[model samples]
Target: MLSNGHAHWTGDDPKQVYAICVASLAPVVVDHPQSLVVGKGDPATLLCAAQGNPHPAITWLRDGTPVSTSQDDPHSHRMLLPDGSLFILATRMNKKESDAGTYTCLASNTHGSARSTSATITIATLHSQFVVVPVNVSVTSGQHAEMSCVPPRGNPPPTLSWLRNGHTITPNNRVLVRQDGTLIISEVLQTDEGEYVCVATNPAGIRRSAPAILDVIVAPFWVKAPRDVAGVVGGRAELKCRVGGEPPPTVTWRRAGGQVPVGRARVVKGRGLLLEPLTPQDAGVYLCTAANTAATITANATITVLSPPRMVDMPGDVEVEEGQRLFLRCTVEGLPPPLVYWAKEGSQAVLPAGITTTEQVYLSHSEVAKAGAVGGTKAQYEVATAGRSDSGHYVCGGINSAGGVMARVTVHVRPTLPLPPPIIAVPPTNQTLPVGVAATLRCLVESAAGVGVGHQPAVRVSWTHNGHPLTNSPRHHIRADGTLTIKG
Candidate 1:
């Protein structure tokens, strides 16, 4: 009998018949094959798993074509494992066969058939030689160094690394590797010189590039340096400097902060710098430079030129009034600044005036006053008040280690004289005047002696009658010489 779409047996005849009922289900993939990149002559495997009511059978397809299994072809390099996986004995790429393509797995049973996600199989390969390789390099110590290389081509791109002298190199603070497979070293030292090789690694294998060499050179250094020299004008001076280096350094000379005198200064091959006929302008700092391919070095020396004392400014003759201020200037120039002194001519006594090494003094009418020196180059002699005793030839002398120089200046002081009252040498004599009769009065005047004519005061005489002044009219007449006449 059939009940609810299920079969049920109720009678048994001779022998019993049994029926087994099971649920029907469609195939479902549990595990899918993964993509793979296998090197040449290397084994590889791809997995596929499924579950269904009828226990689905597994198979693989390559580019829509069923793959031949080991059971189907005894000599086949591909095998179907019992766990529903595909295994390749040895991957290859040749005219006869190539195991490089897209692959998929199919599981099927009586209920239904199902397909898995597609997967690609690629044959891995790597070139034997590098595309770009490092070459020999030469550099100076404390300089930057660089080496670059491009890895070989492969199915999966190869990674890059570096080796030095057959030992692996690890990047540090001063050494680094760029993303483009370049090695960089900052401030390279002598120890960094070695054989360098680029290493390329991939699934196929590891490939090494040709060896490259690195050479480091030493910098120039001073073996002997120059020293300060003292020279005199119209004399010769020499400064020596010696240097050593790996490549033989070249030496040169120059003046610091100024140009060397072209005809007076030159560089001597074996002895060093030579300066002839030295002048005041040539006294300064000089430099000697030694240079090489690696580095440059310099040595310095100072030249001190001595010269005799000379007067740059001298006082001139002057005439001043008595009781007036007087000033005299004298300036001297020399290497070691000279001391200036003032003295009067024909006098053994030197006035404590002018610039001294420590102080300066000014000569007053009666005494000497001390003061500070002025500007180290100029000297001054000052007199607060001029007197007749100060009128004489004054000498200014400058003395230094080199020599001495002197100059003379004359000064005259006029006396301040007092004017005497007008003297009545001849006064008007007693005279008698009468009406209708002419009377004459005479008056004489004289000015003090030694008074200049242009500076004399005006003198005038007047006549008075009973303390009253007289006028020049018809009754009284006055002459140009102070003679008065009266007419009635």
Candidate 2:
């Protein structure tokens, strides 16, 4: 204070307060806003402050647009507090990748507005995504095989490779990976079948593509041919083998030295040989052939056929009338048709020589196949008018180089029924009655079975008075029931 004269100032004086008070200045930055780093949907803030004669107003702008206080908008929201500070309520980077940009805070008043430097915010989409899906592929052998893998580049690009049996495959002359992430195998083979997987990698993360299956069709091949087979006489024999290939090979059975239908050999199903009623002569090598358009394979196996005469048909007990003809038959199957002989069980005499017959009880005329004709023979014994003396047990013996069989036959003679005598079942009875009445006499008789030179013979009835046969006159009436009615 400069007084007119040098006067001393006292407390609580009104004239002393009338001193000088001055206020005049533009806005001055107290704290400049700093850059910010945030993720999508995360809270962010930019600090800004300015000291001015009239307090400065705080404003926030992103890409030169004023930010709204409402967070529901599609942009970043910032609220300016009374203390000249900018507060980002919420971020707008949640929608798309375009939200990643610079953000700035401005402080303004009656003076000029000043904004902070750009805040380079990076909102990374955190996950890895696939664009191209691999697919399954099939190719024939000797053809090229390709397993494609095309995935869109992501935050971190992915790597592609081929895997077989869960292991990464190494590229050789015939197999290699193309530059565009395609697995290529030239001249595909059966061994080149597997799944190809593509893996994507980037700064964000790693991802894998769906597995692509590669299938290669191969030709047919046989692992084994027919093997040796052995069978008993009159027994069945079969030969088998193993086969391996694509589109399985067809197998056929053939004899090693001779054609099929030789002796008693035949093809069973499609894979083996069926030899029935085998003899020692049937012991030889056989071949099983497996073939396809691509390749053919053959294998040999030996067959041992044992010989033993086996009875295929035997006569059961024969029954005939006393004067009826009888024939007993027996059949046997052997490697070679065996000699069939007939004999009586207890008689010391040998059976007479008879004609050789091909008729078998079990084998009808049409049922004799080539194998049956070669391995079987039949015999029969005929009795002309069988009688009581001819009823006896007969034995049939079939002998072959391998073995022999015996069959017994029992013959029976049917007896005739004895004739029965004729008798009267009911005799005639006399009846007495009063005058002017009718009298009836009844007579019944029984005829014996198989008698009287005819079947079911009926007895003749006669009515006689005083030992005379009665006639059917006007006074006497005869009934069909052998009753005579006499009226007096």
Predicted model with the maximum TM-score: 1
Q: Global lDDT of each model?
A: 0.79, 0.66
Candidate 2 lDDT by residue in tens digits, 212-321: 76765555433335666668755778776665455677777766776665667666654567777665546677777776666666778887664567787897898887
State candidate 1's TM-score.
Answer: 0.41
lDDT winner among the candidates? 1
Give the CA lDDT, 0 to 100, for residue 103 in model 1.
94
TM-scores for all candidates: the values are 0.41, 0.26
Candidate 2, residue 100: the lDDT equals 51
Ten contiguous residues with the weakest lDDT in model 1: 366-375
Give the C-alpha lDDT of model 1: 0.79
Candidate 1 clashing pairs, residues 3+ apart or interchain:
none
